[model samples]
Target: MKIYTRTGDTGETGLFGGPRVRKDVLRVEAYGTADECNSAIGVARAAGPDPMLDAVLAEVQNQLFVVGADLASPNDSPYIPRVSATMTAFLEEQIDAMETELAPLQQFILPGGTTVAAYLHLARTICRRAERVVVSLAAEEAINPELLPYLNRLSDFLFVAARIANARAGVDDVPWRKP
Candidate 1:
């Protein structure tokens, strides 16, 4: 079987249970952004500083795939697994755990560190973009409401994870202050 479907030659794509829509459809954008975020997480994981962080990043990569799959399905599609509260809760737990090991945030921090931390920062930004795309999609379509919370919390988790990576690597978080 060849990988090229060539079905999208007309600038349209299919959802799991719905008629094909434009490739630029909101659903496609949302899932596409999720895909982008997943790749960013992979990059971060490759440059990850510690074993524990590497594990967590790996888990996040898996979870993002779940999210991407969830987005790929139509709202009425029963074939897709639901992204539940438990997933978002897990991210919250990770965020809390990472925060416990970091200094309190008093200012906006610049994105940089060991290569791992920088890639984490990159992931965080992409996560935010994914969240925004999901938001825009949800505004018009009946998306899984859980997606909003998941993306929202995921961004927060990425932010803290980046800090934790920098901290553990003995790297400083560059802070922003009024000039």
Candidate 2:
């Protein structure tokens, strides 16, 4: 397929099941934000955080594609591989693993530090945005019920992963302070 399909030039785009929607539709917004989050993770991955971090991030990137497909494809349209409770559980397991390696949090930290750590923080915010959009979309229409929990866990995973990246880099978490 040619890279320039020009199909979306008119402010509309096609969905997985052969239907078009305006670019600003909730479904479009949800998947678009998911894509944005995935791109940030990709940059973080490219920065070479660590072998273990690299592996988790690469898996997260692949999983986000599944999330995008779930958001883009209509429900009741066929069995497309989707975000599932198992996936969410896996994130929880990873979170537990990372948390054990991190010191207990006493306060909220500002989002920054090493370059890859900053990128992980950036990805976390984008993941949160995607989750919000996905929630909004769920409220308005049918979606995989599993997606919300998956995204919720994903944001937590990103936050934990960012801390791990900073820790491995020998950088402390930048704690927030009152002005």
Best by lDDT: 2
The true-versus-predicted C-alpha distance at residue 83 of model 1, in Å, is 1.2
Candidate 2 lDDT over residue span 1-179, tens digit each? 79999989999999887489899999999999999999999999888889998998888898999999999998556666788899899899999999998999999998888889889899999999999998888889889999999999999999999999999889999999978
- How well does each candidate superpose onto the true structure, as a TM-score? 0.94, 0.96
Find the 10 residues in a row with the least total lDDT in model 1.
Answer: 74-83
Clash number for candidate 1:
0
Which portions of model 1 show Cα errors greater than 4 Å?
none
TM-score attained by model 2: 0.96
Give lDDT tens digits, candidate 1, residues 49-92: 69999898888888888898899887666677778899999999
- Candidate 2: misplaced stretches above 4 Å? none
lDDT value, candidate 1, whole model: 0.86
